[model samples]
Target: MATSESGSDQTSSALSDSFRTPYYCEENVYFLCKKLSASGTAAADGSDLFVVFISNEKKQTPLWNQKASKRADGVVLWDYHAICVQRKKEGDTPLLVWDLDSSLPYPSPLTSYVSETFQPSFQLFSEYQRFYRIVHAPIFLRYFASDRRHMKDSAGNWTAEPPKYEPIVAEDGAVHNLNEYNEIHAADVMTNAGDFLNAVFTQRLGAVINENQLEEFFLKMP
Candidate 1:
């Protein structure tokens, strides 16, 4: 577990170290939590980081009500949104939830966000019922970084050729070939300013109504 001084600016350092994403919340938060867990476990005392993945299935959640592009099926999918939860074993710092979807505060306190999102007379975890899913961090890390599919080589090149995949045998005696999962995971390390700009902004993303031509167009935004 990481230590922190309450009300200090130090806690925000973790947020700064979190890698940028192409507005892909699922991949972004997964990678961020993995990085934080690895870094936070190196304490002098033998304490490990605790991170949680919160999934919302209720239609009333903020994600389900977002104004952005949603699925055409008129149903807010569970995998559509995800947030990283971290509880520090330090001071009185509240549990932090990282939802980088632009609509919610980047690093929001868990309770505060829950209060805002849940029903008016909600109890912490009791009222959630079947609408919430919680998975321990370590177990999730197993499935997350199991392969180097989206990663690069030592010389800064694509790790492997396309159609790169792993083989798996299904329960029904069927063999399935799974492609390199992260082949298109938002361009691992942003190539250039243009790449960064294009990855983040869509036509109507934040206040900019038009698609940007280049990085300069984004920099000049009010």
Candidate 2:
């Protein structure tokens, strides 16, 4: 994945375009970020930058129509969405997240973004479930752990020595190796100038999200 050393917006957009496809966000964050960074290093604070993919526990609202909700036993379905997160070093500076589709301020502080994005329906027992993986790009790429990736802390960040690509189980129980997976799908996600904005409008992919939904989500925040 090639990127230009331009402004942050361009850089971010470039990065997102390179990652927006169905599974690239997950794979690239674990494998590509550090290699692609202009400086072959971590941030000054020693905290690693990360790319986070998130979604409600359901298949994406399909382009044509929403899918009927269904779940068996312990199965969890995932839709598609990705963002950039940078851990704060310390001091008063806040930990922030960057999402291209968000109406909130770009690079939103984590506390505020979390409070606004997840709103419970009931005060007593309402809890929305979310699953995430955070890869510590620098350490994982440099000094890897013995496991494919190891949990280093409660924040869900992972660290591990880069693995030699091998057949791994996918969400649907299919076997795939990262190398083949990227070869097939990477081009599908890579975008040229203006391609992303066009996809946003034409595909109705939540590029222009509903302000009312955001307002309602926040209004219910406590």
Candidate 3:
């Protein structure tokens, strides 16, 4: 459920879906949470890599209440048209946006590619093969931003440019056919996020994926 807090330096208040949107920039750590806090994770307030977001609680529904992605009902998609326009100004790569509905457990979109719960070894392949859905979780976006740094539009002018994307259907029936988007997934981002937390809070199961391991994994992707 969304809340109304007085605006702060880290927040950007605006209109979205006809209601006020409260975007909070929080530390990346806020993305981490104990197993109990499903809908109410911590915000980036001031201490860590500030992650920014708006709570969509004004309406009594899941943040992804609009409708599920037809191809991947498991995919809570976000249309980042506005962010695309803005990114063109900063020469930043446009982002893909969507919030996950943890209320349900989604089947792994990559189940067909290989049969293993995500593990360190799974990182060794083209990103397309390793990650689920339309795109790989974070590396794709990071590369996108990197690519946009010096992008030039069709005008032959290097004005801050937006990316161009063509959606294609994956074997999982998920679609990857857009640009300027963001997906906040419980399955991809937090499902494993919780794995890390579980290791920290309770008994460790699998070896945790370190940043270097992740880097090697994604970098190995073509």
Name model 2 segments beyond 4 Å from true: 1-8, 28-32, 35-46, 50-84, 90-92, 99-105, 120-128, 139-222
Superior by lDDT: candidate 1 or candidate 3? 1
Output the worst ten-in-a-row residue range by lDDT, candidate 1: 203-212
Query: How would you encode candidate 1's per-residue C-alpha lDDT over 1-222 as one tens digit per residue?
Result: 122334434544455344544334445555566565555522322122222233322322323322243644222323334455555555454465555543344455555555443323533342222122233344333333323333456776754432223422333443321122212121133435454444333211111111112223323322
Model-by-model lDDT, in order? Answer: 0.37, 0.37, 0.23
On a 0 to 1 TM-score scale, where does candidate 2 land against the true structure?
Answer: 0.37
**Pairwise TM-score winner, candidates 1 and 3:** 1
Question: Which stretch of 10 consecutive residues in model 3 shows the poorest summed lDDT?
Answer: 81-90
Worst 10 residues of 2 by lDDT: 60-69
Shift in Å, residue 26, candidate 2:
1.0
**In candidate 2, residue 174 scores what lDDT?**
37
Q: After superposition, how far is residue 116 of candidate 3 from its true place, in Å?
A: 14
Q: Give per-model TM-scores.
A: 0.42, 0.37, 0.19
**Could you tell me the lDDT of residue 173 within candidate 2?**
47
- TM-score between model 3 and native: 0.19
| TM-score preference between candidates 1 and 2, better one | 1
